[model samples]
Target: MRQLLSYGLFGVIFFHLFFPHNISAQSVDTVYFSLDMTEPISEGWLKHGTEIVGIRGDQSPLNWGNTFEASDPDKDGIYEVAVPFNLHSDSLLVSFKIKVDGVNNPDDGWQKGRNHEAMIYQGVKNKVTLKWADEPPQAPTTITGQVEIFRDFQSDNLVPRDLYVYLPPGYKESNQRYPVLYMHDGQALFDASEIGQEWRVDEAAEELIRAGEIEPVIIVGIGNTQNRFDEYTPTEQVWRYELNRISSQERTTFPEAFAGNYISTEGDTIRFKTKHDTLLTMIPGGQFWQPLIPESEHAFFLAQAGITFTFDVKETEVNQVVASKPTMGGDGDLYGGFIIKKVKPFIDQNFRTRPEREFTSLGGSSLGGLITLYLGLEYQDTFSNLLVVSPSVWWDGQMIISKVNELPGATNQHIWLDMGTAEGEGAVESAKALNKALLNKGWSKENLNFVIEEGAAHNERAWAKRVPDMLRFLYSKN
Candidate 1:
């Protein structure tokens, strides 16, 4: 079984009632969208005759998969479109983004950040005006504390990237050493995120420290690169195959009966053999026997031969079948080594840090969260506190759970594991399973905190909302 579970019953009901597929015309409200393309037009990025502007969103008449065209009938730089919504209640929220030169052209434009949100209500203008799509939102003046950047910090184990350090208040005058909290995705941690949305960690930390709700800590934001997926995942995914039910005679074609196994690499091709000596072979990206061959390196469509193959890979070897396509990962150990061997030493040397395991914490969300847990397990002496938020436990067939099972016993660490009720049932279930695994491995409830946030989505905004709570849980003065 996949071993994943959680869904918000209220969110489900709300979705069904307000955003159903078959919304009646009487309940529909039209929302007007206007995009100012002055910059793109002036920069020659969008040639009037060669390209056009459109909208993509998560609502009717607009979806992320397709583009809806907007027009500039008055020959002005502002393009406009009106989309209808089924607004039975007093208000509805719609998320959308602007795309220039259609969906096929990636170079010209794709709005950054979390999708732009707008609220729709009865007897309202419901107009949304976007100045630009390809730029970061203006930094809010309300940003608290100070941020220092180490431009393109070099690392032997990973690519060079900038490191943003958030210094707590009163660091210069007071010679006090503080605990350090290392977080991944440096770009999204503050107001200057490449994507318009940010976690506002600096603001949250400043607030908590001022209120004396949590201990003041230095936050190190490690920037991510193109190798993010590989760096964040602890193991490489390898393909698994399972036997499909077929005629007895066809089953005899293979030597001995077997459930499934990982596809092994032969001289030049990948092969899977049965215990009784039946063999299946094919070069990746090449054709094999008409109906029994793999179509590509990532897919095998052999339904006719009483055998089924999945492109999805598991971190650990498994005998069951899966349906997801294969993706690159497995560089997490190297990434962790980069931080441990290179990043941390530099931070400790330059910053006024406590430089102790108990004072050092590691955290991130989604895949970053996955790597945090992996590193926490592997390097207990380095990081004694972990903030794992909405971790992708489903990665590599929930291999992290298996890793938890393999541990001799839990160490003395303060661990926080959380998942939103709206982040999908599988994610919630995986978190629940991980929580159970930790308990089974002897982690006391007092040391581990598991939270399921209601109506929270998997994004920077949602993660931002939990920052105060996470900090308090990890560094509460009381």
Candidate 2:
């Protein structure tokens, strides 16, 4: 037996004679992603460990002229890297570090960053089959955050959104249906290691539930999609043409070649942001935005230039309705009927969710919050509890408040309205204006709860911090 073991080891080493010596140490660790985001290259990226990974495979040697590269699905003419997944770990904080012209990690506030973005992939591999590692990147426990991947699987490739759901310590043990809090930007909910970015929603939910301040409510933290600018934008398709132009550049720069990649780098950096091509094109009863990029590789595209241009296009949707329904405008009552109906029923049946007419609740921020308000008012019977976190009451000519005022306040419904003192230029004021309207409509101070996060901003963290408070208000019995 000992001699056979020795022979097996020797055979493995001999077989590797044709392979690269520097291939990631399969016995010790795994390489998750490689990234570069600089130059005229407009390669897109995914968020992994707060860093960016290049999904663009064709962009490589990212130097000035050809610095523009494609990402994950590397066929876009950018350099690419194929991250290895055959190895296993408990979990990992795996991602890439992009440095250009001698830039280093966490530069002082002085240096202009040359580090193009990359993708970030945290947590364990799919289905949780682990290997023999003394210390793996993720643990099997909720405290150690085995619950990651806040993606939406409504359809195969249509709208590949991310989501976050906090499974308490005893989640697997009980079948009791818990109250669910669906949050936007689901990707950033848990994982404080994500720096001051993304809301630490999971951590906060866990702590609050454990502390008994907030009941044990299930938090559904969903990450936004590239089409987020279109979907989340109040004006459904208003920003359509602009996005088309942006897509043209992105497609040209980060074309999705669903194959492997050709990448090279300095100081041993690799571009491993290649994408997978395995997706169900025709999913049952779901919407499809773009084709599903498979879980093929972990690579990156380093766009060296055109940052301002992309921002101009993507950011324009931030404070404005980027697009609306194809035939129906942002205020269209005719569009998205199929998707909304399907999603609501799916959530109700798939999970142990409370009925929308009674204990059910919904909330979001800015445009997201606006949606909940509109939905709740429109379908008052479906959702009885209302939690609008800094709703964009200013949009659509501020018509929602007038609509709410026209109707008599219902004692059966509970409304929790809040805003960050520093949400935006006029966020607090806007919230106050809506609060006043609600008050005039006969909502009492006790029933209509309002709050302001002292130092919180308009991000996931702010929402997470207030989630506990919001939950308490929503489920409170007056």
Each model's lDDT comes to 0.70, 0.43
The sequence of per-residue lDDT tens digits that candidate 1 reaches over residues 220-319 is 9999987888999999975433332221222322222222332322212233443323234332232342222344443444322212355343333233
The residue ranges of model 1 lying beyond 4 angstroms of the native Cα positions read: 1-142, 239-326
Model 2: residues >4 Å from true position, as ranges?
1-38, 41-152, 155-158, 192-196, 233-340, 408-411, 476-478
Mark the 10 consecutive residues where model 2 has the least summed lDDT: 262-271
Q: Number of backbone collisions per candidate, in order? A: 4, 84
lDDT of model 1, residue 203 = 94
TM-score of 1: 0.65
Candidate 1 structure lDDT:
0.70
Q: What TM-scores do the predictions have?
A: 0.65, 0.48
